[model samples]
Target: MAVITKYVVERSGVEKMTFTSKAEADAYDKMLDTADALQVLLSASNQLTDEAQAEALALYLAQQKEPLLVALGVKKAAKAGKQDSEEQTTAKQDDTSSKGLKAVAAGHAA
Candidate 1:
């Protein structure tokens, strides 16, 4: 039998995802953590209709964090040394542009 290796991301003892590459698994896990933190922040807002809406908004914020950061003045431009080169920035935006909130939360590139 051949050997197979996989990186699994688990939450609360339950496997949430499996990836062929460790990087992919790690990234997905990080995204989840971000969403959870955002959820807590949203909770303090007291404006969310319910937990479901809070969770959705949190995930969307996590998935679109890069642009959101820039728009919020939290991330500086490449010329200011906070980002990569212009071409790399363009490519990253292009890759994420097609993905919806769910696709990005799943660590997928559309």
Candidate 2:
């Protein structure tokens, strides 16, 4: 008799499917890891119930049509852009304030 090794996938506490190959199983497991990471990131907490974490993971997996890794790159770019914009705004405000201070000092000197 030939022994077969299979991987089981469970969803919501129920058995969902099985994979015949280790690579396939590893891929699914990695997806779950990504979901868990995302949940922690979005909630800023690691104390979520199993159901809540699973829900978040499922939602993330479903929302992405492409690979999840690609979305992370896009998110990083967007965050960097936002930071740059905020820095520009703060610099402008500082410049305006310094100019106002200079004008006040000149008036007092007159």
Candidate 3:
């Protein structure tokens, strides 16, 4: 028998998302919180009259906060670009390394 544990992020007593990792669940909750805060701030401006549009904008802004900060001069674009390249290199390395390991395991199993 096997048991699996799931992390759920709830908003207003409703399950909004479920994740197999706690880190992802927590990050999602933080994003949701940021969106809620941004929505309130945008509502105060009164520029976006439609509530749905305001909410949508808030979520978008929250999700793209890194790029938003860079565009607003609050973050360095160079740093973001470096991080992206590093992540891509790491992903490529993992894919290549796992391929050889999988082949070795398969040969031993056969």
Task: State the C-alpha lDDT per candidate.
Answer: 0.86, 0.72, 0.95
Clashing pairs in 2: none
After the best TM-score superposition of candidate 2, give how far the Cα of residue 42 lies from its true spot, in angstroms. Answer: 1.8
Q: State which candidate has the highest TM-score.
A: 3
Residues 1-110, model 1: lDDT tens digits:
98889999998999989999999999999998999999999999999969999999999999888878878998875465634576688887877775656577787553
Off by over 4 Å in 1: 77-110
Q: Return the lDDT, model 3, position 92.
A: 96
Q: State TM-scores per candidate.
A: 0.65, 0.40, 0.70
Error of 1 at 63 (Å): 1.1
Clashes of each: 0, 0, 0
Candidate 3 local lDDT, 1-110, one digit each (tens):
99999999999899999999999999999999999999999999999999999999999999998888889988789777799999999999999999989999999999
Clashing pairs in 3: none
User: What range of 10 consecutive residues in model 2 has the weakest lDDT sum?
Assistant: 61-70
* Candidate 3, position 4, lDDT: 94
